[model samples]
Target: MKRLHLICLLLAVCCQEITAQYRVAVIGSSTAGGTGAWPLDSAWVRRFNYHYKHQLGIVDSTYTLAVGGYPVYKGMPGSYVPPPDRDGPDHNNNVTKANAVLASLPVPANAIVFVNYPSNKYEQYSIAEIMFCLQTIYDSVLKAGHRCYIITTQPRTGGPFDDPAVKRKLAVIKDSTIQRFGVANTINFYDGLYNPADSSILAKYNSGDGIHYNNAGHRELFERVLAKNVFATPLPVKLTKFIGNYSNASIALQWTAECTDPNTSFTLQRSTDGRNFENITVLKAKGLRSSLYEFTDRQPSPGKNFYRLRISETASLVMSNVILVKNPQEGLQVKGLYPNPVNQPDLEAELLSAQTYSGIVTVLNTAGMSFYRKETNFEKGLNKLIVPVQFLPHGQFILCIRYGDGNSILRTFSK
Candidate 1:
């Protein structure tokens, strides 16, 4: 009977090793700090904690080293120095402190760090500088034997973001992020939340301000991370023949893998750009041998689409090679012009573009007198432009958009 009890105890220890849970640490600005999220629990980080503890049966061991309004520079290592007119690192919320805290944890080896400083440094610094700061943080995490995931920039409006040149820079930063960090180590925080017509937060997700996401937006972000299955147990698995194609307004992804463990799972992830990826679906292991699998993305983004697979077993995790598919571009069109009666301080013009280019927007009266005019760049897909109408008299006016490609559009409204 003593031998039987000893055998049971050893078996329990083995099982625990096979299904070990990891600790999560977050370092970021307002969004990760839970601003704009009502009751705070609805914030993405809190929601992730709840899911980790309640659904995954893991201990509530998540820690957030984030503070509101912090930029990437502010979260840098304590040794980092700032450029002229910029503030130095805040040691309290800096990455070095975060690393120190993680090192003191019971299981530092089983830890993952998320770096999310969306759009804070973009306005004051160059893309190269921003990437350098991010690289420093990423290296620190890696040097400590921990995995790191960087969240891409989310959409914002007003202030500097309203300027066409600044908006163009934001696009470059988003693409540069994926180039610096591989797709497997980045998350698409901007994907479904931005209004394609104009790069602002979608109305349903906006928390009354041009920046920050509301509860619905936070929920969407949490779901994105949940779909990532980052907490899954890592396993050694071989995946091959990964490919995808677009047809009939859908993208079909197919792949085969050598599955050894019955506890193995496969997660399909998709991305609009080749950089940040989000989870699409999760599949359980079918057999103990090589098996074929396929999934169709019915609502693929227009133009290039990227797909990859994350296979997880009881003791290992692997990511498949990325594949791309191309879809026809949606042509340019005016989606909407709101506040026609001009009761608000700003009139919004929503547009869908087939490609990216600069355009001139003019607000004119019935007698062809120009009231306001500005030139802005438009990205492919949906975009929203804010036109200030407060200074204009309460009269009929025309909104004319002249494209750089020698094309033009016109809409009429009254204040």
Candidate 2:
């Protein structure tokens, strides 16, 4: 049986490698799991997948399971009571509501299950309850035969934050469990991104509204968490403008370029109210080459529009500025994504030129999902994978894929 299991694992991996595809997921609570790839397109998960394709040369079939108002294991401990007006009738219960949302999805192949273990609720419950919830989620994922990643929940409770208490509490749960189990998969969300003193990266990531990010906040989140490839590099790009498409359901954009990298293309993102944005789509360019280029955001909606082009490091340590999508909902730019976006799977690129290459992709969210999977030879170019969108509720996302030579590319799209 062990041999058979090993063989199955090998086969599963082989199929993905050959196709260069993936079906990944993001799971957790509100800020960490909020809908729309805030820093990216609709959610960080989707953005992670896109970055995978652009930089690491992988495709993505991504899903997100983060929801806005649900806490983890409410009866346990530190869980806070959302304002009665905000939480509505059944806001008190925690995982019960989240589980209902998760239960509806088609679990993906080689699923990446991210759970916010021992959240603020752990503060209220005894260590035992916190441990029980942790074990339950772990065992459940193991039983389902999926790979589980345990990231210490982000700093939830920075004072005057949405719930500084909640953030601090979750941090405690993360540290305690890591010490007890000595689990290698455990992550460091605080040092990696949050303000150590405040314990509320969410507040920093959020706008003065105390809920979402301003342009500055969004950019910070992108810089800290966005994964970069160690091998691949993007060609030089100069985006000239970003404007809303009032006539069409899209945004209008243009750019100029020169380069030495293997692939050349532009990934566009849009936002409502200017603070949060979604990876609308990607515009492909014939690779191992360059020239001036122009594109449009045909997916314009009836609202304020924010636009940006993820400028790849055509050389090194080089990035670009954000352009506005003046009129959203204009053209055929992919818009209004579902619970899980980034429909493309991982891809493996074959540069006609002898350029360094990489294929590492990571999916993340505000719910504290971090790290990417290192995959080689995922599939030939353009292979597709059907992934579950059960990571979090509908929201913003990004796909950050790093190459083999210390270069990364980002693509934002919506879920």
Candidate 3:
């Protein structure tokens, strides 16, 4: 692969060699390359590389391979430009040059790979094309036992890429990729751009032309992006318990202050079955440094309910943690199991019910083996049912009951 641009990957001192210790190669064009007067360590990659290991429990080395004059998908879709000096692939190709470098770079299989797709400036490559290029890169570095991560490019400076006509191209590409792959391997990096019309952030970040991130912009890119890759390392986050309850037609949404994307904010959501959720509202965070964020949903429907806080950033990425609000209409709360250690025929469930509903009671052992189950209707009052002991021999179990739209109530018991 050859390119019209000559992009040298910026490197930093290798941190403690991880399992395979291969360098996590960040591949992209000039925006990703980080621009400055030359030889100053102010680029985003360097900023991320400079101070992150100490913050995270572990660390990995970084190598940036972003060039200045290339479009997101390389050559625009219809028109092709030959390499400026034969340094990379012709200007029209999407990732030919980057792929060649990864295949030839001196890195181990276990290293981390972050490929920032070229900005869709020229409409050269389709989302499908980018996905193909990504898979190729993944296979190339997997031998070193490394993992790959991708940042759906940020909102661009100003160009055909940022036009309203194609504004959604980046987002569509990201969502399709995420649905096909999953959070474990393929991640959705965009946090969803708030105001599509403004490209100031993009302008600040881009290099020579206002297309890519300059050194300062690179710093924002990595911190806003690469560092948060779920595969990189779990960010040690402190989330406050959402302290509130559900009342009548109003379901109160509440959450303690939480960390947010430097470039984005949060939108609260509520779910009855966790599987299906609706966005409540979008809350702007107080800059990036302040922690302890909170938000409340003013409206909640009737029934056994749930509330969750979602974090959105960039243009397409959104993540929700595991915090649930248990306000079920025909709700059942398994407060405490009478005798924890026991040799009894059936366990007891003390349920406080507000409404009557039909539900299935299932008892599972520690290994998730369902030992006992039954479908019974509960009256709008307190009900105590004994679980048949003959179901299992001797052991501890996590008992759960599901009813009304699959909302589950949980409690633990030992025998």
Clashes of each: 12, 129, 48
Q: Rank the candidates by lDDT, best first.
A: 1, 3, 2
Of 2 and 3, the candidate ahead on lDDT is 3
lDDT of candidates 1 onward, in order: 0.81, 0.46, 0.54
Model 3 per-residue lDDT tens digits across residues 99-173: 434453344344466666545442455676567555655554454455566556555546666565455676576
Please identify which of the two predictions, 1 or 3, would achieve the higher lDDT against the true structure.
1
Against the true structure, candidate 2 reaches a TM-score of 0.39
Best by TM-score: 1
lDDT (0-100) at residue 78 of candidate 1? 91
Off by over 4 Å in 3: 1-22, 35-43, 54-57, 71-110, 120-122, 187-189, 194-244, 248-415
Candidate 2: tens digits of C-alpha lDDT, residues 1-415? 9999999999987876665343444555554453323454544444455665555554344455555644444322123343443322233333333333334334433444555432434445555556666555555555555545555544444333446566656657666777754554454444434543444455546455444444444344434334222223343554444443445454556565554455545666665434344577776654544455566655454335566666544323333455544432211112223333444343222222112232455555545465244443223233222233445345555555554333454544455
Q: What's the TM for model 3?
A: 0.45
